[model samples]
Target: MNHAWIDGRPGSEPEAVAAAAALIGGSRLPVVTGLATDIAGIRAALGLARIAGAVIDHQASAAIYPAVTAIRDSGMMIGAPAEIRRRADRVLIVGDAFATSPDLPDFLFRHEPDLGKATRGKREIRWLGGPESSADIPGAIEPVVCPADGIADALAMIRAAAAGHRFGEGPIAGEQAEAVAAWMKEAGFGCAIFAVAGMDELAIEMLAGLVFDLNAETRFTSLPLFGPGQAFGAALAATWTTGFPLRVGFGRGFADHDPDLHEAGQLIASGEADLAIHVSGLAGAASPEPEWSGRLPVIAIGGGAASWANPPKIRFDAAMAGRDHDGVLHNERFGSFVPFAATQTGTLPRAADLLAAIAAALGDVTTGAAA
Candidate 1:
């Protein structure tokens, strides 16, 4: 009677759909709808949850919603994924690293690091020789490897130097930052890829302002990596539907996004959020303890085969976003959507489908009302 024991049950769309319907008090029968999320794994959960008439929440909730709020409060620009893959001649990966970014290993060289016919090529206007030696040094684009801890001073120093003001002049701050500032001034078209590792949520808006300032000197842009899995989709969808992304809640007949109030972990820990419809594929298991996982009615959804032999109190299994589900993901390169596919062979659904279903089921609930 309990299909939860079926290993990775959601590997099959049919099973995923059935599981979703169960969560939202729907039937086990088939449902045709679209669930979409910019994040990879959560996309599938969205599809499943929508069919289930359950709420849709992406795993990226922890990282993205805050950034979305910051962006809303401050303001942001537009530079898509295609731009990175095609036009990013010089790429500066700051703060964090992409887990499986295909473009990494010698991507920005005069020609892409390729062995096709042993031919060397240079795509960009000029080829900056050698690997990136520093983050502060201009044209010396490189990965920061800050691991979420060593970002603040580096960012702060860079910001100060770029602003033509001297902030810190220590070993890592003096020559290092000035070098990067010089590079920014020299770069024809540059983009800085930032992530939430070393800095807290409060620093995001300031980070945005810093990036914007760098632009005054040259082509400086910032790409904040939401997190593993479809970080962008969950954040973006929630924001679009309710004016805020990720950690937002619809328990009060209106969707609301707030760090102090809307964080999923905080809300659940405080007994604020009920009927949590969690979406993730990073790790298919849910929290064992209510405090750890948040004490609430959770409809956790995920990708691959169902990993939990016995899911959380209330749960559903979904498909993969990048590996299996058919949908779009924001490329870490330029903030554009990159569409990937999945099949019945591998488990994956899209957040769009799931959200659509939930919207359909909670028909009377306005996007704002869901807040």
Candidate 2:
């Protein structure tokens, strides 16, 4: 089966790779986005971007950045899933985190805490700033329903109360905030879980500050939910390689980090990026067409059998990790890389292999030009 395409026409894999390399070789500025691959694939992308002097961005950078920036700007106390599962006696969930997190149910209900309060025994779950009903959840939960826009103010009040100070007026009443703070202070170990999507940087920083304040009296930490793609994995790889997170550029022959300047969507929309290389190799639901599609020339590498709604100019299919081949991926429960065996073997190309091939082809193009 022909797994490559040029201008939407079927072609051999080598043809697609050569065409993609030619485009990258000729472009003044290329943006590599849609980084939904595993660690190896992301590292290969970083290598390609360095070689081609491209800007690197992940599809979910918007969701991942708030937490990252908050942590970088103001240090936060964070813990892994195993730590929360084993010892966290009180869990304070903020925003629609539970709705977005698929493993929240398993974290909340599937397992019992091993070390907690001797008096209560079971963990106490309190949800803040989301739906009013906890009916969807399996266990008993106390819901502090606040308006979506008022979450930041409510968190501020909570932070004040946690710090033994009183706020006269706020989104959350002084009495309620104090009551919540009292509960938090009574915990043996506390954990605050939040999702960064649709949340502003200030709000995330406030939540982190609240966790920090809570830590003054008792052990407290926070966990941020990741994304629709392998955002955390990509960010992790980028941090280690470039000394920065995602949204890095290599145009100056060294890695430079700038969240606003290197954003893929803005770069494509503003006509700064002449070409875009999109890599989406994770298997599950259909990947959404990027909003910046058709704005510039594009080379797309997608999951083995997945097809895009808006096909780019050049396309190549690659094997998906954990589905078509054995691979390592970030596990939220473990808060680390974990290996998974492939459910089925496939002859399709791997993303890392395809990316390495494109990089090699780009090198060949540069060598010919120099000669």
lDDT of 1 at 101: 46
Model 1 residue runs over 4 Å out of place are 1-57, 81-91, 99-150, 166-173, 202-207, 280-297, 300-325, 343-371
RMSD of each: 8.1, 2.0
Instruction: Write model 2 residue lDDT over 77-177, tens digit each, in one string.
Output: 87888878878778888888866676566765556677755135788888888676667665578888788888888988988888887577877778888
Q: Tens-digit lDDT track for model 1 on 124-158? A: 22111122343323333343333344455566776
On TM-score, the candidate that comes out on top is: 2
Tell me each candidate's TM-score.
0.63, 0.94
Best by lDDT: 2
